[model samples]
Target: MIVMNRFARRAAYFLIIATTMGAVLCTRVLTSVHAQATAPTTDKAVAIMDPTLISRGEYLAKLGDCAGCHTAPKQGAPFAGGLAMGSPFGTIYSTNITPDRQTGIGHYSYAEFERALRDGVAPGGKRLYPAMPYASFTKISDADMLALYAYFMHGVLPVSNRPPETMLPFPFSQRWGLFFWDTAFVRHERFKQDDKRDAQWNRGAYLVQSLGHCGACHTPRGAGFEERGYDESSRLYLTGGANDNWFAPNLTGDLGSGLGRLSPHDIAAFLKSGHGAAVHIVTFGSMVQVVEDSAQYFTDDDLNAIAHYLKSLPAREPSGAYNPQSQKAQEMAVSLKTGDVEHPGAGLYLAFCAKCHQTDGRGVLQKFPALAGNPTVLALDTTSLLRLVIEGGASPQTLNGPPTRKMPAFANQFTDAEIASVLTFVRTSWGNEARPVAKRDVAVLRGKLKK
Candidate 1:
């Protein structure tokens, strides 16, 4: 009877232990969920910052392209958050970053701000997807970081807005799921100068390798979706790769589709102005968006260093060149543009594009960008030109800003072959050698039109 009683006592003990463990687990999870659901900060400190500091912060903020992420697309107040950024798992919407006391960063302490930038961790410890690019911001100098905070706090207008819900797949979306990713991926710190490099090189490195975060888009990500080791440490530094069906060209100084020959001045000019004539290329696709908000406002010195630094970067062969010389591709290029009739494509271009973009293949400055030596036409990333053709053209929005006559979209007026012919004629007409795009290419792109 006594032995039976002892056995019962032991059973009760085990039950109590199990109950305790389960409660602790439940508490931990609940706390995490609660924290993620509520990210609250006030704007008092931000409101108190000096105007000069805020101005400096404003400049740095522009450099960071804060509007690119924080701003809502088309409908909402700027930086009030409604932009839907797609990730492999699902869509992650940007959060409100305005100075709003109730809905934004008005109350975040400097430390909290720094942690978020460097570690991709939200104030209450939510993991931001790499889409936020805290990985690159991790390397930003503290000075710049402070200035950015200041600008957002005082220089900019505030909107009482919160981002829409961020959606992710089941367990993957859980805030707890982020714990593993955070532990594995995040390293909160700024860049330390590489003593081996010169001051100019180091400064340039800091900007591109860190604040510019060029690699988030330019450098390829790994299977886990983190940057392929976020710095120049890996040879894949600026090497190109395909992401989400979009191709990122190699930025290493390789001559073919790379910026090998651009002088520092050229690089600076291109970054500041968005037109690089010598390379016969212009920023397009997402890059044009970058110029509209960020690079154009950079100081000339920073621009030069970036240019000098990028030009100095050695060229890399990311993949075998899609040789136009190949038997199949070469034949394909020839068949697409027989130039059979004095066609409407070339005819229309002769009537329209040639006047501003002359038959001599040069463009009228401030009126039309040069097509002859224009870099966008020659780029391996013809996505820009194609997007321009389909969606119409865009002029640079810079210090001088665009003169306001936006390129009109001609989605309905031209056939795929006609569009291809006009582009081919321009590319080949003025020593600009590129593969002639087939009607099939245009037809393929036509299917993606939103309108």
Candidate 2:
């Protein structure tokens, strides 16, 4: 009976493998047929190389923030990719995009380049991981695509540096499976202008949806790891997404955690300088890199357009509304000032955070971010807040921004319960009605960070 059972289990495992291989083969055939049917009849000829075209391409590259992911931290050459991008499956290192025939994309023809960028399919039919953000790049206009090609092929210096190839384990290692994923999720369509909106609005939409690929980070993902929405037509677009231990806050015009309180100018200023004087909020997490590598160099008009589009998004998760006049807020303020340590974490706040954040929960303008009514403070997910407290953070040093400020990590100074208590107090007080943080939440995050 034991021998029979062992044989049965082996048979079942083989059957499962056979089924998966059959499915993959079937999908590969379908994908091949689809490609043949939809392949372009003629390649769009590469634009004539000129200084004007190269300059324009350079500007577009900045808009895409290509270097932010392609270049490794501290020592990487521009676009000689070796950045380690974290994902659910495993670590995916970026490929070298420099124009080196041996190690980079130097051999790619214009058509091949377009296919890789727009369809996530490289030369000789190699399928790229969605980490490349091709879903958003697919919406890039033909003219702009040619400009980018010109810039990459001619303007950028070639480097023979080859980054390590991505090798996800098991079923994930099967690249053909991505064909079905793309067929089901990716929209192979270009941006269509909204006739009802003005040119500026349409331009903003194009930049945000296409080259900027903002949705790649801001929009939430589905079970299959596809972005929930691509455009403003869907409420999920820019409603917040958590990735790699950080939460990218909602960009919609929600009264609480989104940008409803901020104007277009404020948004533009924040993008350019990492701090908006009008709102007293500074950039944190991955957004600091975005400002440093991409947004800070944007032309005034384009910055305003991107800001305009973001502000136009309708509110989705509008729960945390600030009311300074509320009894709870006034009580907390008075308690802190009068040395009343009644609140769960008020005493700790006075000891560590009060100097920077102030007793009233309003931080120093342009230096420390105000906790009251701040979007990060009111965000539903407390992951970023927890991480910030445990492992400190610093303001980005932009060319025109004020001097950078650093927050000391409290992981060594405070226990998990203490950190949770202080964060919970900040969220609940100062008209910020966000949810409370638990000790376990901090403990779980701390353990992950250690790993």
Cα TM-score of candidate 2: 0.91
Estimate, for each residue in 1-451, the C-alpha lDDT of model 1 and write its tens digit.
6535644554454344444455356564575355335322365354438688788887777777878778876756867887887655567888888878888887776777776777677777776777878878988986677778777777778898777788765444555544445445555567888898888888888888777888888887664566775666677777765444345567777654566555666677667766664443455556666787789889888887777677767876532232335564444334334533353356667655656565555565445666654434655555555657777766666775434236677677777878787777655544456667677767766774452
| CA lDDT scores, all candidates in order | 0.66, 0.86
Where does the lowest 10-residue lDDT sum fall in candidate 1? 317-326
**Once model 2 is optimally superposed onto the true structure by TM-score, how far is the C-alpha of residue 430 displaced, in angstroms?**
1.2
Point out where model 1 deviates above 4 Å: 1-52, 73-78, 86-90, 169-172, 178-189, 240-250, 277-281, 318-352, 371-375, 401-405, 420-440
Clashes of each: 11, 0
State each model's C-alpha RMSD to the native: 11.5, 5.1
Model 1 per-residue lDDT at 359: 52
Model 2 regions lying over 4 Å from their true place: 1-46
